[model samples]
Structure formats: structure tokens, C-alpha cells
Target: MIGAGMGAMAAAARLAVAGHRVVVYERTETYGGAVRRFERDGFGFDTGPGLLTLPAVYRDLFVKTGKEPLEDCVELVQVDPCARHVFADGTEVSLPNASRAGVVAALDKALGAGAGERWGAFLVRAREAWDRTRRPLLEEPLWPNWQVLAEKEPYPAVAHRRLLRTRQARTLSEIGSLELRDERLAALLESSALAHGLDPRTVPASAAVLPYMEHAFGTWYVHGGIRELARAVYERCVRRRVEFVFGAEVVRVLEKDGRAAGVELSDGAVAEADHVVADVDPAWLKALTDRPLDGNGDVRADPFMTRPGRFALLLALRGGCEAGAAHRTVVHAPDPESELDFLASADGDQPPPPTVTVLRPDDPALRPDDGHESVVLSAVVPSAADWDEEGMVRQYTEHLLEAAEAVIPGLRDRVLWQEVRTPDDTDDETGAFLGAVPAPALAAGRGRFLHPSNTTRLPGLYRVGGWSHPGGGLPHAGMSGALVAGLIVEGPEFRGSR
Candidate 1:
């Protein structure tokens, strides 16, 4: 395996248990890839994903790989009032975790009488999309006849008639306008996609599954930080006798008999293996081999090359977290269109204050003491932006701080110090091209949202991680590992996890 990411380590553990000697070569000094923790003084923050949704993916990993369950490895705390949404119109709603009825009631209470029912109705449809594509998109390998997935849009959109014409929502933006009539409700719907670096205006209606998945599974936080979950997985891999070589970068993939047989390290040393599983980004993987690993019909690297990355601010605040505070709060942008327009623009202009997510975990492990708190503020921005420019970073940071103030009372005065993480930082850490974060694969928009198959054209080569089948997100990446392991152990006949 090339890289010790969560997905790669997941595959390593399973492969080792299957009687295959697995070795992971990660360029970084540690594991977990983008799932990293930042520490200053005694304050710590999860710089990657703040919460875990559909944790069953990791739960299954532990159950299959060992006798111990996932709960024994790490404490999974379900966040109540899963999220607090502060909309553009000053409407606020605290959504209950995994409670359809509770969320509906909260929405009705906050956004007016019928808002909750409409949102609830949309989720019912979103669940249909989930059921239709869950197997092909998440549990199974990317089918060879993948075009079938492309041509079919699984979302059962409610139809509307206007001027003797009947129409159904095709894109997420259309779903917002046509179905979710309220602007606040639309913002709530679009924010889910936006969090994945997707443009709701153009993203397929199938993307509704994003919010549906979260609502159904509930949001969870691992104790100590999400990094603790990665640590547990790494420990499991070690227990399974999987070998890890950190700071050992694979410069090239060695081939023999037209198959990937091994990898060449940056130090010119070569390690041979029967199969090579890459956990890096597609673009980085392409650069590792001279052979055309993907054909014309395959999911190409060009489209993902410029995907948006995250800009995060880690704030060390002087005051303790407020009593009964929602763990996660989304502060919507004043002008959602301006933010979307800025993200779509290639000119790299100053972005309008973008929608920002403020995370204030109520865990004691994150802070030095009761007097100090660690807060993470993040927003989605173009990965191609000039993040290295101090002016750009400062301007964006100011915008984020301003937006966060809406949720965090006296946020400016409470901040003791702050660390900025831009796409450039993500690029340096994960080696993702331009620090781009990959969005989860969705079935629709002619399969434009789908990721490449885990099985590459190179016979002994396979892909595992967010960049491959099922695309990015904590759960999807874990599934990619499972699929890769299944394919390797059971051969081409493998039908994925049952």
C-alpha cells in the first residue's frame, strides 16, 4: 500500500488478516492523511473532519478485522442537537441528531408552520435516491458498465406543472427552488452539498443523499479528536501484523508482465509485491506510472484536478464553551449567490464572505482547562486560489471571523491566538493537487460526480481511499478500502462486501 491514510490502513488491516503480508509506505512521518490534529499549549483541534457520519463503515471494519468492536477502540459520542443552523434571514434551528420527527418539529417551530414537513418530505425522497444507488455507489465495485449509473438519476423528484409543461428537479438548485420553496430551507439543503465542495446549482439531484445520510445515521464525535479514530485503526493494523514505513515516499510504480509488481521509493530503493494499492489522489497516482492506467471511458483526472479545498481557522479562545451550546453551527453567508459565484470564478478574486461552519466540541480533551476552549472555523474555497498570499489569507480570515461571530458570542474578544490552514497547507500535507478535497460520488449528471473504479487498468494495481470508488468522506473512504481488499482476495469475481 502507498500511503497510510485511513482508507489505506483499513485495507492493510483486512489484507493482513486475510493472510496477505501488507506493507504501507507513507511519505509523511505519520498516518491518517488529512485527518490530523493541531496542538498549541494544551489546546487541540481536529483539523480534518470534525464529525463522523455513517460510522458503521468503521464499525464494520473493526468487527471484520478483530474480535473487538469499534466502541471498545474509541468512544463514539453522538452529538445532540446535531447542528445549529443560523440562516441568512436570522432564522435559527437546532436539528436533533438522527430524529426525523424532532428535526421536523424544530424546523416547524423555527422556520414557521410547514417548513419542517417540507424538509421531511424531501428527506423521504432523498432516502429513495440513497436506496437506489447505495449498493452500486457504496457497497459494490464500480461496475464495468458504469454508464448505466450515469444515465440514471435515482432521485424521485416531485413533479411541477407550469404552462402545460411538466418538470422535475434535475439539479440540486432546482430541488431547492421547485420543491423547497423557502429560501432558508433551500440554504439548509444547499449547505449539505456545499460542505462537500459541490456547487449545489450544478450538482446532481442525487446529491440529496448527502444530507439524508447524515440525518439517518446521526453525527458522532470520537473522543480526544477524530484523530483518535485514526490512531485506533493504525493500532489495529499493527496488531494484525501490517507493516508501515513512514517518511518513505513511493516515487514510481514498478511494472512487470504489464502489471504493477512493486513500487520504487524516492531513495531509489525498490520493494516488490504481488499487488500495489494506492491511497493517494488520482493525479498523483497518474504521475507514478508511465503506463496509461485509465482508459478514455474511465473517470478522468482532469475534472477533479481543480476541486475546492477547505480554508480553516483554529481558534484558541480564552473563555470556556457556553453551557448547552450546539457542537456544530453553520453560519450561512449573507449572499449565497455571491459566494457561489466567487467559487465558480477562475480569476481568483476576493471571495464574498462564504458560509462558515463553526465547531466547538464539548470534549474536555480538546482544551487545556475549563478556562480555555478550542474552536475550529472552516469554509469551502477554490483550491486554485492564491492562498499563500498574506493579503488573501488575512481577508478570508477576517471574513470567517466575522461570520463566526454570528454563532460564537464575543468571538473576537475570546480568541487568544489563531492558526490558519489553507489549501496550500492541505496540499503540503496530503499532496492533493492544489490542495483539492474530493467530494463523494453521486449517481447522476451523466456520472460526472462518480469516482474511478478501484480496479485500474494495471493488472496488479488497485485504488483505495477518497480518490477512488465511492469518492470522498469518512464512510466512503472506508468502503473503498473494503472493496479493494475484497477485489484482491476474491479476484475479479468479488462482488464487494455483503
Candidate 2:
């Protein structure tokens, strides 16, 4: 295996149990690719994902590989009132965890009468889309005739008449405008897509499943920090007898007679293997192979346009967290258009402060003590190159903190010190070009955003990770690991995990 990201480690554990002597060669000195942690004066912060959704992916891994389950390794706590959304219009709503009725009532109470009814109705349609695409998109490998999923929009958009002409919403923006009919409701729906690094305006109606899945499964936070979850997976790999060679940068994937044999390291060391499971991005994988895999029938000609990387602010504050603060709060941009415009821009000036996802976990373990708190503020921004401009990064950091002020009143004053993480950090750490966060695979735009096949054209070579088949995010990456393991162990006949 190459690289020790969550997806790679998950695959490592399973492959080890399957009787393969998995030797993971990660370039970095540590494990957990982007899922890393930062520490300062006893304050700990999860530099990668702040929370976990659809944790069943990890649960299944533990159940299959060991006597202990996931819960025994990591303490999973379901965040109540999953998130607090503060809209530009001063409308605030704290949606409860996995409670449709509760969410409906909250939306109604916050956005006025009937607002929740429309949202509830839309979710029903979104649920249908989830059911239709769930298997093909998540559980199974990409089919040969994937064009069917690409062309089909499973979302059942209601028909509407405008100027005596009938039209049905197709894109996410249209659904927000024609169906939800309220700016706050539309923002709420669009936020889900934005969180995935997708532009809602162009995202297919099938993207409605994004928000539906969140509300159905509920959001969760692990005790200590999300890094603990990664640590647990790493330990599981070790227990299963997977050997990890940290700082062992793989320069080339050695091939013998047109089949993958093993990997050659930067230090001129080579380890032969029966098969190679690459958890790195496609570009990196290609560089290692020194040749392009067969790609005449791939999903897209270019996959780098998926989404931009993250700009984060890890704030170590002087005061404790407020008593009734939600674990996560979204401070919506006053001008959604400007924020979207900035995110879409490649050379444009920093657009208005983008939407901010503020994570203020209440876990005492995150802080030095009760007197201080660790808060992480993140926003989706342009690629790593944009952050290269020190002036631009500083300005963007200020913009993020200013928006965060809405939730953390007197936030600037409370900050004892701040650590900024830009897209560049992600690139240096995970080796994803421009540190772009891969958008989740969707069934629209002819499957343009879908990742490449896990089973590459080169025999004995497979892909597993966010940048591969199932796409980004914790659950999807885990699923990619399961799929790759099944394919390698069971051969081409393996469809996927049953």
C-alpha cells in the first residue's frame, strides 16, 4: 500500500486480515494523511475533518477485522441540534439530530410558517433520489455502462409554471429557487453542496441526496478529537500485522512483465509485493507508474476541477466555550452570490468573506483546561496556489474570523493565538495537487465528477482513497477501501462488499 490516509489504512487492516503482508510506505513521518492533529500548550485540534458522518463505515471495518468494535476504540457522540445555521437575514435555526419532525418544526419556527413544510416535502423527494443512487454510487463498483447513471436525474423535481410555460428544476440552484422558494431555505440546501466542495448552482438535482443523508444518519463527533478515529484505524492496522514504513517515500511502483510487482522507495530500497493498493490521488499514482493507465473510457478527461481546498483558522482562545453553543455553527455569507463567485474564481480577488463552518467542540480534552478553548474555523476557498500570496491568505483569514464573530462574539479579543492552515498545507501533507478536496461522486453532468475506476487498467494495481472510485469524505473513502480489498482478494468477479 502507498500512503497512510484513512482510506489506505482501512484497506491495510482488511488486507492484513486477508493474509496479505501489507507494507504501507507513507512519505510523511506520520500516518493519517490529511486527518492530522495539531497541538499547542496542551490544546489539541483536529486539523482534518472535525466530525464524522455515517460512522457505520468504520463500525463495519472493526466488526469484520477484530473482536472489538469501533465504539470500543473511539467514543462516538451524536451532536444534538446537529448544527446551528445563522442566515444573513438574522434567521437562526438549530436543527436536531436525525429527527425529521424536529427539523421541520425548527425550520418552521425560525423561518416563519410553512417554510418547514416545503423543506420537508423536498426532503421526501431527496430521499427517493438517495434510494435510487445509493447502491450504484456507494455499495457497488462503477458499472461499464455508467452513462445511464450520468444521464438519469433521479431527483423527482415538481413541475412549475412560469409565464405560462412549464419547467422542472434540474440543477441544485433551480431546486433552491423554484422549490424551496425562500432564501434561507435555499441557503440551507446549498450549504450542504458547498460543504462537499461543489457549486450548488451547477450541481445536479441528484445532489439533493447530500442533505438528505446528513439528516437521516446524523452528525457525530468522536471524543478527544477526530484524529482519535484515525489513530484507532492505524492501531487496528498494526494489530492486524500490517507493517508501516513512515518517511519511506515511494518514487516508483515497480512493474515486472506488465504487472505491478512492488514499489521502489526514494532511498533506493525496493520491496516486492503480489499487488499494490494505491491510496494516493490519480496524478501521483500516474507519476509513480511512469506511464498513464488505459484511460480511453474514464469518467472525465480532467478530474482536478472537482473542488478547491480548505482555509482554516485554529484559534486557541483565552475563555471557555459558551454554555449552550452548538458543536458546529455555520455563519452564512450575507451575499451568497459574492461568496459563490469568489469560490468559483481562479484569478479573481478574494471575494466577500465566504461561508464559514465554525467548529467549537465542547470536549474538555481539546483545551488545556476550562479556562481556555480551542476553536477551528474553516471555509472552502480557491486552490493552494491562491493561498501562496501571503497578503491574500492574511486577508482571507481576517475575513473568516470576521464572519466567525457572528457566532463567537468578541472572537478576536478572545483569541490568545491563532494558527492558520491554508490549501498549501493540504498539498504538502496529502500530496493532492493544489490541495483540492475531491467532491463526492454524483450522478449528473454525465458523471463528469465521478472518480476513476478502483481497478485500474494495469493488472495487480488498484486504487483506494477519497481521490479514487467512491470519491472524498470519511464514509466514501472507507467504502473505497472495502471495494478495493474485495476486488484484489476476490479478483474481478468481486462486485463489492455485500
Candidate 3:
């Protein structure tokens, strides 16, 4: 395995179970790709994924491996009231976990009773789409022996979607108009789609399934943060005797007669393999292989990857900052046009205004014993087009920090430490292509092609993380690891090897 990211980690565990001698090479002196956490003083914060959804995916992986995903250690609270949404128009909505009625009730209180009823109707339709699609598109591997999933129900039965070519074609305007009379409510529903990183106007309507999953399934936050997931996978790797070579950068793919062999490390060491699975960035593989760039033999051009890396801010605060919260709170533009305009501003002309995402570790322990509240503030800016670690101008850095402190009073004094991480950090840390969140367009449509999955490409090589099929984020990445294991052992390979 190359690049010990999430997919690489998951693939390592699965391959070890298959009785293969697995070796993982990571450039960083750490394990767990995007899901790793950092500890400073007494504060600890998860780097990439914090909110987790799709519990079944994790449960399934543990079952496949003859271990319990949750029984041994860690417990999933199955968080309710998943998130609190604050919009530009002073509209506030709290989304409950895995329950449409609760969200509708909350919407009714915030927007109007009429708006709540409309939301209920849309929920019913979305639920139908969820039942139809989840089994086929999400659960199946991209391999050839794939079975057709989701008995396609009539579109009308699900929702009234017309004149929309792809889900990308249906913008927030259509969702606002068709789904609910309350424009604010519509924005909240579509906001989940933006989590995919495409323009709300261009994202496909078929994505209605996502909000359903979150509300019906509810999002989860792992105890002690998302890093616990990495520990679980790591523990499994240990039991299987997977060898981890951290700080070992792979220099090149050593091809033998155009068949699989192994990799050459940066320090001139070569490790051989009958089947070489690359869990690193796929672009790395494309650069190494002579394969044409237009498309791979089975893979297509990835729309999610065509976007930029996510700009992030990690803040360390005293444990008590929650009481001194700033009133400026936060605001998100309701429509994609505004969001895209904000993104384009940073494309080279000027530093994009740091769109703020607030993170408060509910765990009081995140603060240092020395009176510091450590919070990691994150925002998705136009990925730093020229995010140079060394050459970044002082003015550019000031702009993001000032923007954050402006919204948060006392942020300067409350901070024991503040660091600015551009899209570059994401690349160096997880080796994600372009180092940003994958757009929904990548995981939305037919999904036959391998985007970033462990089961695609080669037999021994498996994929994981946001780039994998079914897209990115906490729950999806963890589930992907399990899915790869299921695809492998469940096959007749178990009998053949035995």
C-alpha cells in the first residue's frame, strides 16, 4: 500500500485478513490519512472529519473482519440534533439526527407552519428515493460482477423533478421553488448538497438522498473525536501483522513487463509485490504510469477532483471560550451564485474572505489545564491557487485571521495558539488529490467508474477516503474501508485461498 491515508489504512486491514503480507508506506511520520488528530498542550482536535454518519457501514466492516466495530471499544451516541444552521437572512434551523419529523418541527418553529408542512411533503418523497437508491448505488462495489441496484421508481413518486438533466443542473433556486415555499428552508435542505463541493445550481437533484440519510440515519461524532476510528483500523492492522513504513515516500512504481510488481521508495529502497495497491493520490499513479490522461480504461474524468483544496484554520483556545461567544456568530450565502462568487474572488485576484466554520470541542478536555480553549476554526475558501508554505505573504495571512477574529470577539486573546493551513496542508497530510473535499458530482450519478475506492483498479490494491466511490467525509471514509473488506472476503477467494 502506498500513502497510508484512510483508504490505504482500510485496504491494509482487509488485505491482511486475506492472508497477504501487507506493507504500508506513508510520507508523513504518522498513520491515518485525513482522519488523524493533533494534540497540543492538553487540547486535541480532529483534522479532517469530525461529524460522522452512516453507522451501518462501520458495523458491516467490523462484522466482515470477525471483530465488532463497536463492541470492543468506542460507542456511537448516534447524535441527535446533528447541526444548527444559521443562514444569511437571520433564519436559524436545527437539524435532528435521523428524523424528518423533528427537522420539520424545527423548521416550522423557525420559518412557518406552512413551510414546515411543505418540508414534510418533500421529506416523504426524498425518503422514497432513499429506499430505492441506497442499496444499489451506495452499497455495491464498482467491480464488474456488480448487480444492478435500486429498482428505479417513477420519478414523480419520489419528487417532481423536471427539466433537470443531471442533479448538477438543478440549482438551489429550483430546490427552493419546488421543495418548500420557505426559501430559507429550501436553502437548508440544499446546503447538505453543497457539502459535496459543487455549485448548488449545478448539483444533481438525485442528491435528495443525502439529507434523507442524515436525518433518517442521523450523523454521529465518535467519542474522543474521529481519531478513534483511526485507532480501530490501526488496531486491526496490528492484529493482522501489517507492516507500516512511516516517513517512507514512494519514488516511483516499478513496472515489470507492464504487469504488477512493487514500488521504489524515495530513499532508493524497492519493495516488491505481486499486486501493487496505491492508496496515495491517484494523480500520483497517473503521473507515474503511461496511461492517457483523458480517462483510465475503466475510470472516467472525476468531477469532484477538478475542484480545489479546502482552506482550513486550527485554533487552540482555553476551555471556557464557549461562554464568551461572539454575536456576529456566522452566516452562509443561501445560493450557489453567492458562494461561487466568493470562491472566484480568491482565485488570484484577491484572498477570498475566509468563510468561517466554527468548531467547539464539546469535550471540556480540549482546553489546556492552563486556561486555554482550543477550537479549530475551518472554512472552505477558493483553494489556495498558489498556496506556498514558505512564500505566503503576510497580508494574505492577516486577512484570514482578521476575518475570523472579526466574527469572533476575544478570539485573539483566547487563543494560546493559531495556525493557518492552506490547501497545501491537506495535500501534505492526507495526499488527497488537490487537497480539498470531493464534490458531490463525483459520487452522484451512475458511479460505475472508480473515483477513489479500494475495490477498483487492481485485485490486491484497495481504495478508501473521500476520493473513493460514494464520496468523501467521516462516515463514508470509514465505511469504505469495511466495504473493501466485504468485497474481498465475501467472494469465493476465501474458499480458493483456504
Best by TM-score: 1
- TM-score result, candidate 1: 0.98
lDDT of 2 by residue, 1-498 (tens): 999998899889998999988999999999998899999998999999999889999999999899999999999999997999999988899999999999999999999999999999999989999999888888888776777888888888575656565566778999989888999999999999998888898889989989998999999999999999999999999999999999899999989999999999999998998899898877788889867674775654254454688989999999898899989999898898888877777556655778899999998999999999999999888783457677888888888898888898688899899999998899899999888888778887687767777887789998889988778899999988888888888888888776
Model 3 lDDT, residue 134, Cα: 57
Runs of candidate 3 exceeding 4 Å displacement: 66-68, 143-173, 292-299, 302-305, 319-330, 334-336, 344-348, 351-355, 389-413, 439-462, 486-498
Candidate 1 local lDDT, 171-197, one digit each (tens): 999998988899999999999999999
Score candidate 1 by lDDT.
Answer: 0.91
Q: How much lDDT does each candidate structure score? A: 0.91, 0.87, 0.60
| TM-score rank order | 1, 2, 3
Top candidate on lDDT is: 1
User: How do the residues 1-498 of candidate 3 rate in per-residue lDDT, one tens digit apiece?
Assistant: 777666666667777877879888888998878777778767788777666777666665565555555547565666545766666565766666667677778878888777778877777767766766554346555434332221122123323357444332244446566656566776666666655554555444556666777767777767777778778867777777989999998877666765547888888999998766665555666655444333243343343345545655677764365553421133355344555665654444444344445655455545555356656656565564667644443444565466556445677776767677667777778766667666421223344222544444334444555566545655556545556555556752321111
For candidate 3, the per-residue lDDT at 493 reads: 33
Root-mean-square deviation of Cα positions for candidate 3 versus the true structure, in angstroms: 4.9
